[model samples]
Target: MSQAAPGKSHREGISLIELTEMFPDEASATAWFEQMVWPKGKRHCPRCGCTETRKASATSGLPYYCSGCKRAFSVRIGTALERSKVPLRKWVFAIYLEMTSLKGVSSMKLHRDLKVTQKTAWFMLHRIREAWSTESASLFNGPVEVDEMYVGGRRKNMSNAKRRELKDTGRGAVGKVAVVGAKDRATKQVKAKVVESTDRATLHGFVADAAAPGATVYTDEAVAYEGMPFPHETVKHSVSEYVRDMAHTNGIESLWSMFKRAYNGTYHHLSEKHLNRYIAEYAGKHNLRNFDTINQMAAVAAGMVGKRLMYRDLIA
Candidate 1:
């Protein structure tokens, strides 16, 4: 693997060698985590936001002690990594791997690389994905392309017994889940979610949540999108009209292509329960593709704060 440039910052480039060199031990990783979590280089109590804190002891697992709150804490207190027994170095490496992998790093790959159990690796991956979740109150502005894609196996591909068990709705998407996506043409940002149905109400609700009012919306000739709140345009896929002068859902379609590739190639079987997290993982990467490794890591790290996902909560 190529090494990062000497004297260059971590955000510029991060390779395996650079990662190892930068964080050779737990102390280095802890210090770096503290810096990232508290940018001003001062440790504060997560409970009460008190700055009056000191190291608990030389060898304590809970590193910091807060005088105001009378509690012990660490950098992991309120973040996704909270209560995790995995070392800081491994967490750092996992963060780097998650951000750097284009398609996504599998739990098995993380297991082998990080030398953790497959179960632990799986949990760690989910916690890291929790950090990638982004919430924005602002709607997607500009010419937005909206589309829906079905995710699941085809009826013909299933065994005879399984086929008999499933109802033949006479539709291709009979047993598949629907994922609606919206892509901004100008910003190249994507927002997607798993929806129960692709009817007019569902599609319109997704469009309203994603796009601003009066925004130009482009989609295929789907009747569900007929009365969209935005200035709508359509390209009839059934009539071989894929594009008509900057009016097409190709942008969002490309996002679906990427998502399908990752789903089929990397994560072969995704449970419907955790499908939203998977969508968020891919959508976060799609939105932050323009940034370098460091900034991307920083962005993921920034989301780590104020979120906690426990193992029981995850499993439940």
Candidate 2:
């Protein structure tokens, strides 16, 4: 990635015109991707990890041939972009648009902007999300805020049959997917997942995995978070006590607020089956919020390696 200061606007990095000038042709975009995927000017065969390679036939779409694997491969192989027909330049543009947009880039908007089919645009967005999907190896050191949110359509908007089926389920958060999240105050990075339940075991397991030992954990007075292994504190939100001393879930709650805004205002509806991918996208982007737009784009490109999201598998 480029060595640049972190900022949101184009002033911190390349503007649209600058980006266009930087990648005027397919070859230029390909070189940039190669730089990100294989930094330090070292390119290896993705198949066999061999350093020996040579130019492929002119008729072959693949640019290089791996002598060890005896196969031709491009940078797209073994990545979320594998088997994609979209041009690399358009992919770069899509990435820039995806990163720059705080909420997210919708398939319709992306299709319109890139002159691609809506279905292709939708798949492209999901592929980018898959590329950003990652698990932080290090645990949060201290003052981690934990919270859960329900994502789904409103009861009023649901069909009568669906409403009737969920009538006995419960009132608030019924017929909705529960997502638990933790935000590290020090790093300002968040990790979250679409959980099957918000029970004690589930919530506790999440906190235990996310927070390091002896780390301070903050949460609302939820029964699930009653017994935490780490040094824990609670703010009684039920009685309108949000903050007491250094205890508050405001950070995680704010993350939920932003996610909900994107959910409602941008995508409008996120299917439960793929809700986790959307969560990963939001959380990943949130973690990279401070980086320059170009750097953020490079990060996504770097993450593309070792990930492959086939259209068949995605729909399945």
Candidate 3:
């Protein structure tokens, strides 16, 4: 197994040895969790933040007592993995697979790799995605790239007449949801949302929400962006020059490529109902693509604090 030292090369990603080394057993993972969760070592009460604590017993697993709360609780009490039946090792390992992969990993494929049932793998993937979801700051600053992509359709799914219509009309992102994104080139962070139309309201609202005041936005010559109030630069694809003076949608363009490939290659069909959750899932991974997969995993575990995703809500 590999040991991932801090400040490792981002391009190298996770080494196979490092993945294996993460868990010699469930105990190894538990120890690792203790290290992360209690780095300051005070182990304060999650409920009241009281410093007083007591151990249940060495023989009994999950032995933590909080004096302020005057109750016993386990480490999984407030995490996404809370009340989960899966082992911590499996949970952490699943996160590792999700974070390290370039495009993404599918639940079906994860079922094969992790030796879990497909249903379990699917549930696990969704839960892990919830961990990566961001809840801090309001938007990005500086130059932003905005573009739209068509996600759903098949070449042969369309009737011959419809196909001809599409061909004649030109591929203008027809019959697809308009996904708009803002990419901050300097920070390499991106935020994307699935919108209803390429209409001015949708495009402009998304851009305004994602970027800060006076920030420049970059986009292609899409009519949807007509009369935008914010300052933006456009490149004409028809003219065959994509980049002019270091301004282009290449960063966000690259994001679209990987996102589409991951969706097409894995899962295969994405239902429109829960598309936004999947959007948040991929966006979290892409936005944090620069961080350590393990560190990112740790952050997600930490973030699961005070949040809840009920199974009923998930099914609904």
What tens digits encode model 2's per-residue C-alpha lDDT throughout 67-88?
Answer: 8988999988878888999999
Model 2: how far is 82 from its true place, Å?
Answer: 1.1
User: On lDDT, who's better, 1 or 3?
Assistant: 1
Decreasing lDDT order of the candidates? 2, 1, 3
Q: What CA root-mean-square deviation does each model show from the true structure?
A: 4.1, 2.1, 3.5
Query: lDDT score of model 1?
Result: 0.84
Tell me which residue pairs clash in candidate 1.
11-294
User: Can you tell me which runs of candidate 2 are displaced by over 4 Å?
Assistant: 2-11, 159-170
- Mind giving the per-residue lDDT tens digits that candidate 1 earns over 190-242? 88888999999999999999998888999999899998778998999989999
Candidate 3 residue lDDT tens string, 1-316: 1233333364345676777786878887766666666655667666677778898666545668887877666666666667778888887788788877776788888899889998888878878777655634677786888888777867677778878878999874666666777788767777877788878888988887888888888889888787777788899987997999866899888878888888877768887766776777777777665566666666666656655666667778
Give lDDT: candidate 3, residue 197: 81
lDDT of model 2 at residue 193? 94
Give the C-alpha miss distance for residue 55 in model 1, angstroms. Answer: 2.4
